[model samples]
Target chain A: MTRALYQFLLWLHPPFFRQRFGEEMLWIYDESAATHGVLALFTDGLASLARQWVMRAGTWKLAVAGAGGLLEILMAGFFVMGPAPTAHVAATQSIEDPAQFSGTWKGSLRSRPIELVLAKEGTVWRGEIHFQSPDGALRSAPLEDIRVAGDSVHLRVQVDDSDMTFSGKLVPGTLGSRLVGALQATADASDDLISYSTLQAFHA
Target chain B: MREDLSPLVPLSPAILHILTALAGEERHGYGIMQEVARQSEGQYKLGPGTLYDNLQKLLEHAVVEECSRRSAADNPRRSAGDDPRRRYYRLTAFGRRVLLAEVARLEGVVRHARLRLQTNNPRRAS
Candidate 1:
């Protein structure tokens, strides 16, 4: 493993340097293998690459790398120390008959057709949602943290790389009646809505 | 702009070690590695990747340049039967100044740390 890592590190050098000093580098590796070992070699290889990137990369590429590294840290921190769930809608009492909300309902938001399949599990509501993504890819996302309270129903799903919370009123009426509500899509920690759209559902 | 100011002040350990090893005499790559390990008492060692990469940087910075005159007797790591393509490196004048400045900075840091340690320890304070 040490020999292989040493060869890999040597290969990272530019061709001209490799041609000039490759043999001497190998000799050094052989002499210092006992002291440096494989782990140190691997760490040095990474450090060498990072230094090369910082020194050699163009301004644009350096900016992109900086942004990418920052984004990764922010994303990891977001998950580890996620924002408290801000209630997108006022809480209401749990539905007396959650079973009435069960069955498939069709809706549209921003001109995109959406399908919602709701089911009652004892006192709670469970659902699955299907919609066409922005890239025109059909995505079926399981709705989570579903709560059905009286005439108000709320559920959350991940869409378009954003957390989308859909809260609407389920009015018991004729079979062809309309269910109306609003959708809140948040993309980051601020919990501010990136996009808010009205949602209308009809039994399909 | 401070154009005359040296850009190598905040030298990395690997670069500093390489410069220190070559300060007294010109040595090959392996020679630098062995000397650095010996100088640090085996506590800090530079792997071949790190050593060569910093050597490239130092060459670009003109702080150190390659020398072609190779004598196997000069480097104990090179055997009599070994290939004679050993590349030797020596620190330029600029590198010497940088090394001195960095060493002084390190000395100040070490002195302060030692003083604090002794002051905190009542037995040592006496």
Candidate 2:
């Protein structure tokens, strides 16, 4: 919910401003959102929205000849109106069998053990993730944006300020099965994907 | 080119702290936040709004520039603490000049303040 509002404010910025620093701002927000208070986080985003519109060009580097105005309008439209740019894997990927991922599995991520749980609820997939934090404490987060495409699987869980996304394929080995993919924590579901590759496959 | 950074001199507390944080190496927003607190020993705390507000201005004035994420996290200081790998910002050449100018300007101010206070002290004046 707070993230939804943060994105909404991000959407409110001028097209040019959004084009340059949308993901950057969101990245920073996610980094601190876990440790900082909500008031501090939202206040910064709200003020930036107002400032970006008023300041015009905080980091404007127009490399093109006359495409500035045109690019601004197009980007603005894309952000405000969906449909045209909704071909992302999260939306385009189809689930052949959601039941395949309907069990708890464990794997090593970032050299730390991670556990993920997925359950289908009336055609909808829902689950949570668990991992050991830096302080040697266990932390868990609910799963969101569960996308499955044939053997490809993608799951995102909101951990503190950032979204931890897992993308791997289900591999059938002689010894049971494993979800072999990389788990990455990103600033947003879309925008920029910061790939901290963890190739440890989880076995049920 | 020796640009006149005097107009931008006497940087605001927030901007100065931010530039100082970026002075050593490129950093993400969270890195900057942590650096500011560490440098100031928690005397000065800059929320995200103020940091970016000033950062936007710094970028506008060409005092700062963005760089790739990989280049930032590969620094020697990565082991010093935990700074998440996010979009990174570095002080541009022009930005370094502005920061040095501000620092020099602050140095003079501190010197003058110390001398003035010392002279006003009865024991020191004697």
Candidate 3:
């Protein structure tokens, strides 16, 4: 089953990519699959998808062919017939019930006020962030990978040239308030990692 | 006129690690991955996707080249059991210079950060 899933993920990648690094990738995946859980494999598959997208962006051949359009469609058909990767693994670790996240969260980092408006979407939490850019201009970006696992709350927001990830504990504060315990935010760029800290509070 | 390395300044961690991995000896993809993990103390493990993408970029930049099997044989250090299908890569002269320049640039940033930190926390400075 794992082998079939691995092959399906590999098919999602471009042919030139398979021609070059396919064997090595499979070798590594086999080793990793033996140790890591299903979540990790799914994460790797997502990473492979990102790499394929990058390749398509850089190469006209893949872009023009829609990354081997017919092959991808056939592969997708096969994938639909199989159990989805998401079905096998719980992506988010919900520490606090997502229902408790209904409200507005306001925090300040690097002297700029950041606001989060979160609401429950089925079993998961979804939200948008409003913040001031370096230029002091207001901007709102969709939250990416918002997860509440155990006492930890993790969310990623895309900023220009980088992605800012926040991982910290959720502290139940005074009535109608949720305080972020030891908030640590890391802005990851291709070349650097910049970090910031903030005292976060959300009010219902 | 010389080619400008400025455009490549503040090189991505992946590119820097690849160049650093190839600094002492030419390595195939798997070797490069192992060396980079070792260098980063397992903090930055490059999956095949990330590894090959950076390699493709490096090849395009003319900073790294894929060596032929004959050249690998010339090394005299490579093991006889080395896989023939494995493609080895090494830094070109230009790549070495870029690596050095990037290191220097990073050092400058570190120095500046230190100075600012000292100013921000005078007690720590003392």
Candidate 4:
């Protein structure tokens, strides 16, 4: 039964994945089938289907295909809606070079802590933060949307359902300093805030 | 509630590999292939078809996430001058937690096997 189900998934995959990976994948399927038998074929098929669903769920079509049609439809709905904003931000901004952002910057938000680390890759930055409220509750979020422009650095921090964009000027001296300009949330208003004393670069 | 049991349990090795690749960072299809190869030290080579198929299953499980659209420039395997958009992937916290659990489960099997082997061959244990 598992083998049959595997075969069925394989049959469902080519049309779905070929649209993105081009014709090369079809040849791969043929080659894998020649060597690894039905198991390899099924593995290949399942992998392709997994890739499509992850990368191209936005393009999925829900037309009934067979006994699995209902499953497909249900999966489509889950794919479209699962992974709320937090998941989206993490997945989208997972690539950050910690060297570039390895500095301490101060901002003024009473609720959130602001610390950025720039790593060796030279292009990406990861911001680590801590949030503390008056009631003494603590929370933390990783800031992935970091952009460096000339002497200015921009950091986007997502807290819960809202995204806050912070623009700061890099102060030049023996050490790098950042002065916060304005902090605004992208969507939905929340009382959670961030504040800094003096932004300082820290060696990671 | 019992019927609510997972429809798909005991995910395939390919699916596990795909999930493990995304656990640290987001990767595109080829990126995933490369990472999986690296992780297994080339023991597991996933062709494009197989890579994408496993990706779909992980996506269905919400264990893998699509990070973004990639241009040719984003593809490390592409020539430096060639630019095309390629999607990136990352493991959700849920995905990471689940993968860790799966790893523990697999480790349990290995531990049991080792115990059996040791019992069967006392010299091997030494």
For candidate 1, list the clashing residue pairs, or say none.
Answer: none
Candidate 4 Cα errors over 4 Å, as ranges: A1-15, A20-204, B1-9, B69-82, B122-126
* Tens digit of per-residue lDDT, candidate 4, span A7-31: 4565565443443344334444443
Ranking by TM-score: 3, 2, 1, 4
Tens digits of per-residue lDDT for model 1, B1-126: 333434677788788888889998888788888899889998877777678778866764557765523332556655777655466677767677778888988899999999998889766454
Q: TM-score of model 4 relative to the true fold?
A: 0.38
Cα error of candidate 2 at position A15, Å: 2.2
lDDT string for model 3 (B10-108, tens) is: 899888999999999998777888889899998987766677767766764557876644666677657888655566788878789999999989999
Model 2, stretches more than 4 Å misplaced? Answer: A55-204, B68-85, B122-126
Chain A TM-score across all models, in listed order: 0.47, 0.47, 0.45, 0.38
In candidate 3 the C-alpha lDDT for residue A99 amounts to 55
Candidate that beats the other on TM-score, 2 or 3, i.e. the better one: 3
In order, the candidates keep a fraction of the true contacts of 0.45, 0.35, 0.08, 0.29
Write one digit per residue (lDDT tens) for candidate 3, span A1-204: 877787777777765456555666666666556544556656756686676666433344334454355555567678777633431122232235645666787875444687888777787788897887667889898888888755456788776666666654455544554545323235445432233333455663
> What lDDT is reached at residue A187 by model 3?
42
TM-score winner between candidates 1 and 2 = 2
Question: Candidate 1, which CAPRI tier?
Answer: incorrect
Docking class of 4: incorrect
Quote the positional error of residue B108 for candidate 4 in Å. Answer: 0.8
- Show how many residue pairs clash in every candidate, following the order shown: 0, 0, 1, 47
Candidate 4, residue A161: the lDDT equals 70
By TM-score, who's the top model here? 3
Q: Point out the higher-scoring one by lDDT: 3 or 4.
A: 3
lDDT string, candidate 4, B1-126, tens digits: 122214434557887888888776666666677688899998997766667556555554456555422322354545654323444567766577677777877899999999998889756464
DockQ of each: 0.16, 0.15, 0.05, 0.14
